[model samples]
Target: MAIIAGSTITASQYIACSEKRDKYGHITSRISGASAKAGHMMRDNVFQTPTHTKEYDAVIIGGGVAGLAAARMLHHRGMNNYRLLELESHTGGNASFGSNKYSAFPLGAHYLPIPNTDNQPLLDMLAEAGILTGYNSNGLPVYNETDLCYDPEERLYIHDRWQEGLIPQLGTTKTTQQELKRWLDEMQQLRAIRGTDGRYAFDIPIANSSVDPAFRELDNINMRTYLQQKGYQSEELYWYLDYCCRDDYGAGIDIISAWAGIHYFASRKGKAANADNSQMLTWPQGNGRLVQHLQQFSKEKTLQQTIVYKVTPQGNRVAIDYYDMRLHTTQRIIAKACILATPQFVTQRLIPGGTYDHDFVYSPWLVANITLDRVPESSGYQLCWDNVIYRGKSLGYVYAQQQQLTQVQPERQVVTYYLPLDHLDPVSSRKYAIALEPQQWVKLITDDLEKVHPGIHEVIRDVDITVWGHGMIRPHTGFITGAARAAAQSSPYKNIFYAHSDLSGVSIFEEAFYHGNKAANALADYCS
Candidate 1:
């Protein structure tokens, strides 16, 4: 459309430009790697008998972080006779990335917060990946300088101009300022407080959190309700809290459990020699870099483009029936133990007649990687790693190449835009997002960007979209501490184990890694 300042683009031109493929010949559309049709076929009980059968000591169904972690744990335990199956051609699940000629960008998950010092397993993994270089004299781990997020970390477009940080401080009233201070003070106390059980009141992996009922009861109400009960009444505070919920849980304060929302603030207690807890580890390609490290452990044993439709427990073994997308054939694997690392929604279809009644509500998300010929001009602050627009429809965009160490910034820049479809229910939102046309998505994105960066359309070179129907698990009221979650975590059969972030009621890398490792440990114990 070649939109310039003070000029509007025609709908036809917008459609034309939006449909234009990137340098890699990839168009702006929903990611096509997932096996949605195969999932439907599995749901409909449309199965073909396997023409071939194989045997393995263990079988990991799904190739996301959870599954990959399971594979790594199995190898760590000296179990080499195992196979990992993935529906997509590539692994990483939500941590996947895509690239064009200019830069590589994230498809879904983009960053990892510093791991809590108590999370030794995660620390070990990061150390192995060289992200955690070594410990300092004071015992705090030192991270790789290049891997840490660079300077100009965050900024927010508020009061018609970019501010230093995301907090709406530029135009905030005294009441809002006081409320924000109170919230921060309370969160700081909560961050240091431990329960009577001697565990942190809130911790990553969620299971490691204190089991005190006083804190556990927070899961019985929504975050908004919690704020109201505490006499918090600031519009800015409410908006900022809602934004935080949407950024992490893919939902808002009204929908997320108070425990989860508070955990978002209080749980991050990671101390590093070089970076603070607020600092995050990121790359141009996002968490895909971590995935690359994890993939090495499962490289020779992982099978891509394979859909495991059915998993059943035999007398002393587990039978896994899978369909090969490339070969158009079905195969069977008999294993002594099996780990179903898929989400609960997909796991239900794989194992028919399961009695576990889970109330898992996943939030849908839309992520777009926009390639621009030049950086869009803005007021108040220069482009930062994470740039957010106050009260914007989407979470705003991240400067993808902010981690680049080159003195001369590239002429071409890529920014990943994130939008959680939480205006409606998850089902309706998913449908609405999937039904959006390429041009409609382009308009939605460009319209939002124009609000902060006027005439940004003129600089845009390409836009690639990825929609995650079941993006991440949401911890609703009572879901985290409910019986359904407990049942979902248990193994119905002796030879089968469940492992996914959904079981933790919060979809984050640490929980997924924990569950995967937990499942592998259980399987190893069973085999012994």
Candidate 2:
């Protein structure tokens, strides 16, 4: 359909999502064509204030993972004179969840890696969630067996059969196998190498990575250039590495930074007495459970459906102007300190001389949840938590309820399919994504799945599609160690602070949580 006239969508086609739900969670009959219009309005909204005003010690805008973390930290410090404002009716930003009678599934992010030994905030969150029981005599943490992924952790569809893991070496030449092994061994060696500063060359949250000029210079070039310079020409290896780039950065390897590319492999140092770095921690509802835990503060104090459009320094306080969509009133808040915990794109638009204008590039993504009456049997392995195709453009689906522990399998199942729009520029990709009709998406999704599961098309009952215009930031060449990234960590104003995953040059649960905690500590010192 074309862009509906007059921003607000009262049209029948867009409103049919409510009609499609069957006594369970609401289903998306279409790919939210209304979001494009709504998003434009949000960006283009003008700022003004009515007669209403409120006072608080701090005010947090944008209730995503970062905002929630800041709020939770502030509450833990006994700072209750604060409020959180969210643009959506619900919280959790990308870490949202949905449910039906059969199961609950993730809407965006699905899992978290085992925390590195240096990442204290992440480990604390996991321990509070009951996933981390205690430490062993070796000083390594012990994980709850239930939270760790069960047997048959992963499988890949290739060579007309399912393999035990995602690596595709079932039918390659001996030369290709040797090359792949060489790459794996190199990664292992790099993982253990430390810098002159006694720090691992690359570690979680990216900030703790070694600052040695030898390694830091890797950010000056793209991953493709780095790979080609190393005399690595294995097509299979490139395909696998390219898949990793698309899965994490939502961009092609040619455009992603070499430092970010290698960091994807070396930064993960998660270890446990019971689980290895390769093991993951996940739930049926994904990171939404973590979002809920962070939001365990005063609900009555929060202001949902609120848009913050302006932030200006007012003497020793920061003046925040926002409009509440639910109340249809514009209000003002004079906060002693402020945390703009929003995406880079949104934050840049909210204030003057905004950071990240020249260095940040956010990616666009597509996620479709497929609800099936019965999962059709495939030719290879029965089923695994994560299923990937050897050379496919889209990352294969994840079994949504794979963590459910029922002795007997349920009659129905759900799988979430992910696709990154990297074939074009971000602006063009978002336009093309929103213009696609529901039937067009259905055809595309079915065609992608039919490669492995022959009859999956017939078993699919419902398909809900969610499109993210600015999904996550891409760490392009010269970004990770550049001046723009370093300068973005602090705000121009003394009383106003900034926090978001984009500031870290990469988007992930660990980085966002760490960024929020760091910002909270900085702002807390000044709040008193």
Candidate 3:
């Protein structure tokens, strides 16, 4: 059967491929080999340098959002004798993006939720970046309308038709509808409910969330167990919550903690004069735009393609040894204070035999940018910024050009698709993801899109896929409440600061920014 513009495909006819080739034959992106290159680092041996050495006030590892944020904070505090190192050629890390003749598309992370008023640091950053317009008489922040996600924010493909929102309510029973409403209402109520200690049920940075035993107990069980205990048997509710779990934490509800699942809903307490928590801030390049803004203060201070292999504490100072890929030489850098902004897995490798030997697990993900010569028509709803296929393993796709204010939309557009490879273990996920040649990845995504847009594969001009072996930190049971996570944040030695989203047991922009600034402040006092 030939593919049609608005044709419907039954489950039997839905062709899924582990391997697919781009019918139009387009080139893969520059960042396509990132995962492979990074995979070989541990196995590759580098000669240590004895003669080459440099000193700075501070030296930071990892040029991701956390490192950049820490570097920016140090710069803002008049600390110019500092340097940040990134293993990759770019600074944004997972928030990095790439552009083509079509549009600038994300390689990994995308939108950001509006910050809550209490999140002063984030709000201050937004204000400085001109994203937050100003405060009203109520003191609520007024976000820039241009920065807010445009109308027609999200759409869902369910039962062969597209709906206005991501939730699958079409063809649902009364019980299903009631369960959906009940869950959402309960989440809204819980958002306002505080722990016994006067902390919100959930909060950004996660560290601010209540440590009350009543709430912390939720961290000991998986989300599925919590739902079962609550007597919620609705598959609809389960699918929605599970989708949310995978979307945010990159893991399924069965593996994610109850606290984390709820945090996914209640944690977003963003109240704006112009927008709500549901409203997001996005751009053509995804969160990379925000990363670009954060880099304004630290780009010149950052050295890319330089990997810090080891970090040890010395007399009142810290020592760092790194290998520069471009220079093909090893060098040593010593600083009065040091911030290890790398992930826990990497941190463990650099400085082994630490008390904080936490069992941190990461979820892998696949991000592909599919360029189209001309847009395709959907059966029920028009394409929106975020689009989801109900109950699919994939988180679906985002329109790269959706955030643009072009009166005349271009014929060419790029759709960035996200697929969290969490169905298997990390090792297996990496294996499966790496096994997929470009063609197989094309089939995997286009096949899923074809279920909603019949001929989405035909309009494709190009496809570029990225495999993140350790995409993001998973908030598993015991990760938040257990002492292991906190221990991971401890620095037994002086003048060495620990900073990374993993220290918070979650990987997000806000957490990274929070820990970065917090470490910078700590390092400032220590250095002084």
Q: Pick the candidate with the highest lDDT.
A: 1
Sort by TM-score, top down from the best: 1, 3, 2
Residue-wise C-alpha lDDT for candidate 3, range 1-528, written one tens digit per residue: 212112332333434322233342453432273546653664264556645899999998888888888988998888889999888888887888888876898888898898877999999999988899899999999988888999889998888888898877888899988888888998999889898899987889798998888888999999999999988988878998999999888898999999999998888888899887689988888889889898888878889888677787888878888888898888899889888887777777677454335468888888888888765887788989999988886888999998778788787889998988877677777776666567656655777788777777777877877778888898999888777787777677778887888888888889998999999989988877
Candidate 1 lDDT trough over 10 residues, lowest sum: 1-10
Question: How far is 441's C-alpha from truth in model 2 (Å)?
Answer: 1.2
* lDDT (Cα, tens digit) per residue for candidate 2, span 87-113: 877777778777777888877888888
Instruction: Evaluate model 3: give its TM-score.
Output: 0.93
> Which 10 residues in a row give candidate 3 its minimum summed lDDT?
1-10
TM-scores for every predicted model: 0.94, 0.92, 0.93
TM-score leader: 1
Q: Evaluate model 1: give its lDDT.
A: 0.86
In angstroms, what RMSD does candidate 3 have relative to the true structure? 4.4
Score each candidate by Cα lDDT: 0.86, 0.80, 0.81
lDDT of 2: 0.80
Cα displacement (angstroms), candidate 1, residue 179, comes to 1.3
Give the clashing residue pairs of candidate 1, or none: none
